[model samples]
Structure formats: structure tokens, C-alpha cells
Target: MAARWLKVLAAAPLMLSALTAAQPAQALVPYVAVPAERNLEGAGLGIAQAAARLLRIGQADDAARLAALTVQLIPDDPRGWVLLAEAQLRSNQNEEAAVSLAKARELDPKNAGILFAQGSLALKDSRPSEAADLIREGLKLDGNNAGAYFDLGNAYILMGKSGDALGAFERASKLRSDFWEAINNQALVLYEQNKAGEAIKRWRRVVGIKDAAEPNLALAAALNVAQPGNTESLQRAAKALAEDPNYVLESWQKEQLWGPRLRSAAAQLLAQPALKADVERAQANAGASDDLGDG
Candidate 1:
């Protein structure tokens, strides 16, 4: 059956053209080489694999085009629709991605991944309540997804449920021990909740796990607040700013979901006269990047 469909699929374009050019009366006659259902599904899966490869290679536009074709070939296949939705998301076609995800959910209502994807879209759309609910539902179906829990924590943070957000981040970090981002978020919530020492401890641990800019700067801020004019904190703050100047900008920190309390601490750390040169350089770098983006 698969072999027969492969042959038919290979000749499909020619057959379609021939049928189009046929006489009206002949065209109306029934044709009998219909593809078997299983064969079509196999073909769709094959195409989906190709699309996945394209997506992995950074050819998001091509991947989306192929995934669109896959869904047309197997409209009932939830996997095809999910692939289409992912490609659409990569291309930043959020509305179309949402529609594709909805179609996939209709095809496979029990698919936890689809629910998680929808929840992520909702979070991007700033509907935190809806995002939380959808993510919770997905977790109910499959609770082991560390990334899903991380997203749930972000949603809870947006909803101002700091305690819930902390728990969610803790769960994510526990599920994946090397999940520094989740651990870092737990610090954000902790600091917002007035647990400064705990937040500082987590931030230090995050820096140990990964010498990334966010945790480094956050730790610096916490230390500067706890111990004024600390040399190590000032040095780390300078290094972090040099590494990723965007963290110097309040807007960027807010985008990273840094709570008000943390942001205030960072502002104080950045305002230090001892690190005047570092702050100026970071600000200049950030401004240049902003200008380049505008251009």
C-alpha cells in the first residue's frame, strides 16, 4: 500500500495537470487510484520529518511551508498540526500558530504538549490567568516537564502570586537540577517576598552553576544592598555589565521578570560612584544596540 501511494504521490502533479486539461465530460468521470489512508498518513509523517529537519537547520520559513503541506495531506493528524504550529511560532506568526495549536488540540485532546504550547502562547499574549490554567491542565496530564513548570512559574509571577511562583520554580529546578534559569527565578520571587538572604543564596548558587549575566548582576545587587561598597560585589557587577550591557537597562530587567525590589537593588548597584566607568560603558553599549535595532 505504501509503495502504491509513493508512486501515485510522485505522479500526482502530472496527474493533476492532466486532469485539469482533460475535456469537461472526461474530467467528470470517476478516477480509481485513490491513495490508501494508511499510505497518506505515512507520507505525511515522512514530510513532517523533513520539515522538522528544516526547522532545526534555521530554515523556519521553509519548515513552515512544508509543515503547511503536511497538514493539508493529513488534516486529521495532530502531530502534523503541532509541527505546523511550531513552525508558525518560529516564524512569529502567533495568531496562525494559535489556530494550528487549536486544531491539533481538537484532533488529540489528550496531548499535553499541545496544551503547553497553547499556554505558552497565552503567556506571550499577556493573559497570565489563562496561561496558568492551561499550563496546570497540561501538567495534570504530564507533570514531568521542567520547562512547563518554568513557564507556569512565570505566569504565576505575572499574576502577582509570588508564593505560587516560587513553588513552581522550585519544582522546575528540582526536576532538572541544572536548570539555572528556574533557580534564578526562585530567587526573584524570594527577594520580592522580603527573603533577601535566601534570594542571595540562590543567586550565588545560580552563578556557581552558570556564570551568566543575569544571576551575576542579581547577586551583585543583593550583595551591594546587604553590604555597602563591597569590593567583590562591585567587581562582579562591573564584569556582568561588560558581559551583557542590556542588564544595565531597567526595561530589559523588567522584561526578564525581575521584580521591583530586585530592580531597585540593581539600580543602586549601578549608581555606585566606584563603578562609574563600567556603568557608562554599559549604557553606551545598550544605547548603540538600541540604535542599531531601530535602523
Candidate 2:
């Protein structure tokens, strides 16, 4: 009995080890860490700045694509929508620009700049009446906007309200003394109204202010009409044509919103035998037909 008990004690340690080895191990729970929060608005602003830079560099299509992404990232920001609208406008996607502007308006209804932008788009879409109304409303909110006044003048001109258009142009020039475009339009309206002397005076002032093609050509045409076969006028016309050959094309003139009176005057001036060579060269440069028709 004593010998059997000793053998069992010796085997006990091996049995205990086998039992420990046979037991199943417990599974460990995973430790999950949460991600850091993102500053989405700041990211959107950075993207918008990049888009604006692209636009400035004349990469309008790329600017528009990036602006679209920016709006998606910050849908609540009206500025983002406005930037997107500007990019879309530059890309010639007028309908998409309108939608983006509408969203901006919904977000910030009282913004005068947004209203002015909408008015400008209305003018581009050929809705002059709506454009005038929108611009007028914008002026009420921000009365000192010279560019808005200039646009309002254009709207009035399209609606055949010459007197109102003149007033608007004058207001624009008064608000911003160096606004040559508004002054030029004033001359345009004056010429249309048969005030050749006044138109010539305004055109002369515009040329003095800025040596641009539109005012230069306009003054040349007026001078030719007021004093036929004037050598100075012919010389000025030649120089203006060289500066911007597009003035030689009637379609281009109309696109610049040249009134019928101004266009007729330009046609007569261009028909001068002394201007034949200059007109031909200008036409060639503009890639237009040799015959300058009064369209």
C-alpha cells in the first residue's frame, strides 16, 4: 500500500502540468481610437482661394471645377456659392451660374453685391427690364456702387429709356470721377439723341482720360462727321483701327452696344477713300470680310 501511494504522488505533478496546458486561453478585446475632427470650413476657404487664383490666371474651367468642390465642402457659406457662380460665369455656364447665384441669394438675401451680380446676369440673358429692376434694388441697398450704376445705364439703354440711361451714366461718373466707361456711354447716348456737339465733347474727355480704342474710334468718327474730310480725323481713325482691329467690324461694334447713330457715323467715316487701306488692314487683322457692312 505504501509503494503504490509514492508512485501516485510522483505522477501528480505531471498530471497537474497536463491539465494547465489543456485549458483554453482568454481572447483580448481590441482598443479602438477615434479620429481627429476636421476643420472643413477652413479647408473650403483654402480651396476657394486656390480657385480664385486659377481664375486670375485665366484657367476658368479648372477654377470652376475647384469652386464646385469648395461649395460642396461648405454648402452653408454664401461666399463659396458666389465664388462658384463667378467661376461658372467665366466658363460661360450661365444657367449654372444663375443657380449658384440663386443659392447665394437664398443664403444672404440682403447682399447688394449678390443682387448686382444677378442683375448683370439678367442683362447677359437679355432680360433688360429685370436687370434694371434688380440693379435699382441693389442701388437702394448700396447706393455708391459706380459699376452698378453703369450696368443700370446699360439696362435702361436696352429698354429704350435714353433719358434714364443718361441719368444713370451721369450718376455713375459722378460717383466715380475716373469711370471712363460710364462717360463713354453718356457720349453714346448723346450721339443717339442728335447732340453731336455734346457727344464730341464727352468723347474728347474720354480720350483724354484713357487712350482706349472705343473712345478713340468714337472721337474719330464724330470728328469726321462734324468736319468732313478732316485729315486729323482720318489720322485718328487709322491709329484707332491699328490699336483694336475689331472696331472695323460692324458686328463687333454692335456687340459693344454701339447705337445705330454711332454705327452709321462710323460706317460713313470708314467709307472715306483716305481710310480704304487702313480699313482693309484692320479687317484683315480682325479676320473679317473686306466689305464693312452696316449690320
Top-TM-score candidate index = 1
Q: For residues 148-222, could you state the per-residue lDDT of candidate 2 as single tens digits?
A: 999999999999999999999999999999999999999999999999999989988998899888998888898
Query: Cα deviation of 79 in candidate 2 (Å)?
Result: 0.1
lDDT of 1 by residue, 5-50 (tens): 3464566455445534646665554764446678767867887887
Off by over 4 Å in 1: 1-25, 28-39, 287-295
Instruction: Assess each prediction's global lDDT (C-alpha) against the native.
Output: 0.89, 0.86
* Clash list (residue pairs), candidate 1: none
